[model samples]
Target: MDGPFATAFSLIASGDPALMQIIGLSLRVTLTAVLIACAVGLPLGAALALARFPGRGAVIVVFNALMGLPPVVAGLIVYLMLSRSGPLGSLALLFTPTAMIIAQTLLILPIVISLTRSVVEDLWAEYREQLLSLGAGRLRAVPTLLWDGRVSLLTGVLAGFGRASAEVGAVLIVGGNIAGHTRTMTTAITLETARGQLGLAVALGIILLTLTLTLNAVAWGAGQWARGRLG
Candidate 1:
């Protein structure tokens, strides 16, 4: 046990090429998924929170529920949808990086939407009275309100990215852990650990944790700076 642990530390210090590749791939997939989630989720969440419509509460409830969905369940759904004979099977995207990205996007979209809604909902409440008192049209008020709540909206994006980057189950199931192809840090770590390659696994694990930490720290600092500028 001690020997393998020591080897793991040593391998991590060596900075292996395979390790680098996995790390890079993980970042690419996570970033792509987060970007897609933001593009689709931000406006939808704002609409859900700000627009007056029938069944709006139900939509909010459904999104909130999906925000808590288990990763394995999401993975299974992706697997079925992309596997042979499945509805989307003709695309032939299973076991590919694109498939992993799609799965992760699905997993994180609900999170982004729910968090964005929460943030925007608060802003809507705070500004409703003031905007109405001034007789400002809802359309004119929306842009200003969204800008004022930029920090919170950014927080929601960060939350979604963080969640997507750290997720493993869905990515693993859909990506097949193919080396130099679909392999990501999370999948690599699992494969290495399963094969008793503890050294490589630990090294990858350390890198993964470090990357996640660095990204989140940068996001937090940026949010703080934005808040300061707003102030």
Candidate 2:
């Protein structure tokens, strides 16, 4: 058998079209999902942290629990919802990139919301009185707390991205892993390894690892910058 590392490097250096396509699709889907999650999650989380309505505690508990949702279960639910006989089947999203985006977004929403809530809540506790004394209401204070806690919220976004990028179960069920279509890095790796194409699988794995590490590095740098500002 060819050494996996050597073969991986060779494939990468050769700019294999299939590998490039998989990598591109993976980035596009995951990044889009994360952005949509952030749009919904950040506002919802800030509201949860600032509001004190009845049943708020229960709502918070449910969201926190959902952070531990199983990937396969998520995939199953999405699959059912998008199936031909299912509720959203009219949209014809099943076995497509859109379905994959929906699946990943669902998978990461709870994580983003929970972590954002935690960060915003903590910052709100510190800034509440100050904001109130300055004539700021809860609505006005939400933005302030979110801005102050942006670094931590960013970390949460990165966490969601990581979860989206690494997961295969949900996307596989929804996307169908069609070549040059819905296939992504994680799904491609699974396909390659299953077909005993170790070199391609290893190459994809390396690319995935590199992307994840780069994201973490960016988060780390942002955290450091925020700390410096705080100091």
Runs in model 2 lying further than 4 Å from the true structure: none
> For each candidate, what is the lDDT?
0.84, 0.90
Q: Which is the leading candidate under TM-score?
A: 2
TM-score of each: 0.89, 0.95
RMSD of 2: 1.4
Q: Model 2, 1-231: lDDT tens per residue?
A: 767677777877899998888888999999999999999999899999988899999999999998888877888899999999999999999999989999999989998889988999999889989999999999998778888888788888998999999999999999999999999999999999999987778877987898899989988997998889785
Each prediction's total of clashing residue pairs, residues at least 3 apart in sequence or on different chains, is 1, 0
lDDT of 1 by residue, 39-117 (tens): 8887777777788898888999999999887777888899999998899999999999999999999988998889878
Candidate 1 colliding pairs, count: 1
